[model samples]
Target: MKKRLTWAAAIAAAALSGCALAPGPSLDSKRMHDDLGAPTDTTVYDVKLITPQLIYALKQADEADAATKQASLSTQALPAESADYRVGPDDVLGIYVYDHPELTRGASGNAGNDMSPLVDIGTLQASGGLGGVLPQQISALGTNGQGEVDTSGQRVAANGTIFFPTLGRVHVDGMSTQQIAALLTRRLGSQIKNPQVDVRVMQFRSQRIQVTGDVKNPGQLSLTGSALRVVDAINRAGGGNPDADLQRVLVTRGNRVMTIDVNNILNRGDLRQNIALQSGDIVHVPDHTQNRVFVFGEVPKPQTVFMNQGRLSLADALAAAGSIDTMNANPRQVLVIRHPNPPLAQLDGTQGTVQEGLKKVSYAPEYNKPEVLRLDMTQVDSMMLATQFDMKPLDVVYVGTAPVSRFNRVLTEIMPTAQSMFMLWSIARNR
Candidate 1:
């Protein structure tokens, strides 16, 4: 036992002596970030000097935030009359002729040239439920002044005209139900006694919109009316796909194109982009490509933070990633890596090709070019710097750790092994 004790003491003494002789921890945060600033192929910009740009960006952001709030505050609904869905081709309409019961028969029975009793839509539906007779299918049973039995209800032709009994071919292409009824009433007043007509649109089949790209179901949709908003159309297409970029939905109508940030509408209650959709419009939700900023290094979460309202700043990115690890991180050594803006090429008399232009722009700098910015919060206010520095997509925010903190972390990891060795040495010496 005594021999074993002597060997253990010798081993413990040698281990302690080796640790004492070893070089001290040299993980200086400022020195480590020195290479981060003004390094090879990197252009360093001091945050203090760019106060003018920061002020402009922050002012714009504040104005935009206020505008978003103002939009949400407005409670006035869109004018109902302004959204009057104009009647179009393929629409099913229910026509009613006052005082003439025989003129209002369903499409089922043939237009009997005789004066037959008119069975109203309510009576027909009540007899055998909805399957009995639909209101929109109701048509005049008796013949017109020309003695022709028009059994088929009015179907707006491809040429935007509908064949009527006495009225012959009526052009109802952009006309409303009320306008059609008034026209029929005025024409039929001369033929019949005190003629009055009523028209109501039953089925809206004309306005078909196509929703594609990042939608659960990408296909054409028949809009019920002009009331179909952008949000409603997206929902009708089975909502957005899992990887859909809600912030950058493109809506195209011929030459006019607009991008809608649905995240602002859904999350921040901004409804300015929730505009009314038109016929032949295309709504496309694209895949989430460049919608996140990376905050790594000494942050608590060190995660890729997604943006709202399609805009993000350093302050928002840091807050989203749970801020920097204050216990072990140096707030003074914050670095943001960004892409450098390429200068415009000298335009010649001739138009240049896209590839040639790209090549010319490539001469400016690569995307990974170290356009690094060091944010020294120790000298200036931390909040001020964070708010001023606008973080673009794919920008990397890294917070480095202090040298003393790094040394402390190293010692914490080695302390357990050192303590065990010390205990063994104490036991051996006592023995």
Candidate 2:
């Protein structure tokens, strides 16, 4: 019996040697691993101890970053009045000459059907600059006093040139309306005395921009007359949805991609963020579904916390997870894991080639290493520090287990195995 008791004692000691392995779910401190590795002072992941001063500095840095971005974007944004739009293929032109009623195509009021060898008002107007940003009003603006320039003008040929009576087929492609009128006047001067020629865009069919995601009405907007600014197009699209994340709006223009914070334009009334949109630009407003933080371990309820308006304090996230379990949780130790977002780099789709003959640039995203942070919740100022600490997306807050509780669990698990071994030893001795 004495030898059996000694054997049991040895088994218990062996079980205690393996006690380092966790008997249950537990989050370990990285400090132990840091000391075990390569005699280096630095741990694998960044471990920031939560403090009041650190939280304040982070807040200051965030404010400075936002201000710098705002200033930089404002300088690069287009002016309020962008350059006049040039005529393009599929565009419609309305030509009006003062005191030249006989020369105008539909000026004779043949219901614009009879094509004058010179001006065909019948073929014109039925087509056409977007007529200001409000293309719906194109029907009200007429060069021949007809209903709409779109319905009354001559649509530009696919070759980007328009044909008129005296000018024959003068090149109007890529030329602004003012430039077109001046060129026509110079050419028509040979046929008439100082012809007062006026050219206005009746229809703008060449350039279109798409607005999608989180908007009330996601669709295309025409770039007619003047260039459409970002804000103007969004307003035209019926604003954004309730869960729209305006702070991270993405605008993809061909090979270039830009992140615009629409909140500056809507909340702070900063119009500089409203950059001029180009044809083929795709504006996307993402929602708040991606803005979330996870809380787990030693908590009453482990769940995800959704950030409101792109902001969530660490304290709030912990509270939503039901704080910490007082029974077996160690208030002295808490952990936070944060992974940085990969750089945003998306170019022209699957074509992979930015443009023909140009080498395809690789936009392979570089993922950053995640950071692990420690907090001593038992400290008096810890609550205050947590309140000021802003939580980012994909952050994980973990409450560590009490050391005594962990040791007890280890003993509890091993004791049953130890008891089973002792029972088998007793049966062997009897045999």
Candidate 3:
């Protein structure tokens, strides 16, 4: 034990021979952040300066994103409303063939031996129940004048076919109502002269979108005859929860996953993000637990701060972290390290390098792959600008250490070892 202590002491003495062992660059904050400067009032500023270009670049990127999303929705996602809705299994189809009252007689309302009556949805609802439902609301939820359900209306079998008086069990899966009517018309042409046939979908029960995760009411939302958008579905589900991260709403359709910025629609009224939701789409509004900004460096309390609906500013983040350490913090050279959206780590299936992933927003784009947004909190103009300058998710707000504080830190690192070595030297000489 004595030998081991002696060896350990010798090793410590040799290790402490260096004047200091402080990590990080000794360069002052100003020198380190040479590219960043005060916010410019004019539109035309030096391209070399980083902060001014950020707002414009971010605006451009947002527009590009919105356009891309809109294009995807318009071209690929949104189904054409003008086209007739194809009848599927469980759908209530009202069929009538003119001159043959026998074929149309039993199919007026939900009164049939083979099928069950459509349950009153409004009765099942918690709020008003069956008593609270308005006549119009009931009409909307159930079949209205548009296509009133028939008593003898045939329910499509699980096999996707319905039995008509003369047609027997016909495969009407993926066939539009008009097409089905024309098929019946042509097939019955042999028996009757000009068989005027009409077919309409009374109840749309086959298609539904599921709403899960942080929402007031999470369940399957039935898709009606009319087209439903993301907003409409959310509203029907009793809106998002208080902690819901509406900015990063996830819509999973089969294998494809889409991130929707629903915050834009509710706040800025950006209609583009409110894309039409198709049947079987699962909308999951995640909580704000992951949507946060980190405050570090010379902040009094360096911690994660949750952003309410993605509206956190530099000032807000600072305030949440108990404000900056004014004594040691270089307020003039504050840095906000912003990682790319969906971060480079989590690729959005896009083929791009680290630099390209950043979306070209900052002056530090060359050396710093992730943007380093600088803000001079010392300046009144700059500080005011920081209020308007929104902080995105995963932004690292760093109040650079003061030059004097950096020097003090180096002294602090070496002082304890220096004192120990001096005491040892005195002890050996006195012995």
Candidate 4:
């Protein structure tokens, strides 16, 4: 009997080793939960469901804070009256002198003059000469008998001044063309008898604004009339592309950049984000590429969901993944793995105090440490909590399998092997 037992034990050990080394489909149960990597440096947090009133209050606070920030950054106030387009350096101005045709180069008399068509005012002034600058620009006004503009318009110099015949240097920066014409008329009064000066901005080359990224026609937009609002520039560029994220549309001014949610303005009637863009403002509508959240485990479709309109609630993400399995999913063990770091809230999305949310749920303060938060979907009001929970980029949502289902799975896997072993034992005994 001892020898028989020893032989059976030896055979069983050899069989187990052979199966371990076998190159074939694994007999082990295949499930997503099986590949859940070992947990390391994880802090678990439970869902905190607040009253509807509290949620409303929190939203109000966030909106107010956003409004205040928007107002402070919008340096130029919305114009009460139609704002005049101010001239800047490098703008081309068409100067016309009535009756005194000789004052302008375009006049028939000056056609043969030894002057280039476009005379740079700044260059002429630097050379300690005033005669050439005026003829170069004003000659266009006094055309030859054919009534054609011979000279190019006067270009505003870098120093915001334009040189006229006798009027050495006149500052025109930030002044309207009409304002410039009036000033020139007064200055040219002594030189030319009753000088009637007429200034017309031929080409608005100064206020060049860039509206790029995600627009159908992205390029430089010239700010011609009244101050161009953020929306006007967007419209001028043929609006945002289909995949453009209206939320978090960036407006870059000099060193500072501000993101505005156009969706909020359209849906929630939040007009604070519609800023009057100044010169040098670059409007960029980014493509909705990075807006995604991962969902795995017991869901019918464990996949990544793109955040629609720069926002995806917890419920939305779960729904996008086809929701948790009703039969075998642990509703209490829905895990959200997130890492706390950096400038807190995103530029435009569901606004929430990161510190407050993390602290309220007792999350780890260390940014490097990953936090494993448990959202109990079993509760009746859990959906409300999910609505308030906004999904961030790269957030992983995992639904755990029910304990009983796991046990049944294990049992199903072992029962076949157990039956085979019993059959082998009986065969050996019979032999």
Model 2 residue 316 lDDT? 94
Give model 3's TM-score versus the native structure. 0.69
**Error in Å for residue 29 of model 2:** 28
Q: Write candidate 3's Cα lDDT for 1-431 as tens digits.
A: 56555755775676676535557667556657565577654533222222646766876897796686667756665556544666788877877665464565223444232234444444445344332333444333333235553354678899999887776888887788899889998999998887877776666767779999999989987665566788888888899888999988878777666778898888998887687777789998899887898898898899999998778988899889888897899977778777655442333444334322113222323322466667876665776677767888788888888999999999999998798867765655454
Q: After superposition, how far is residue 372 of candidate 1 from its true place, in Å?
A: 6.5
What are the TM-scores, per candidate, against the unseen true structure?
0.56, 0.69, 0.69, 0.69
Model 3: clashing residue pairs? 106-152, 107-152, 108-150, 108-151, 109-150, 109-151
Clashes of each: 1, 17, 6, 10
The parts of candidate 2 lying over 4 Å away from their true place are 1-43, 67-81, 102-151, 340-367, 419-431
Q: Please give, for residues 327-416, the per-residue lDDT of candidate 2 as tens digits.
A: 989987788887643212232233232211112334322233566778898888889888888987678899999999999999999998
Task: Compose the digit string of candidate 1's lDDT tens values, residues 241-344.
Answer: 77788876777766545567688788877776687777898999887666678898888898888765467888899888888887878877788876543212
What local distance difference test score does each model get? Answer: 0.66, 0.70, 0.70, 0.70
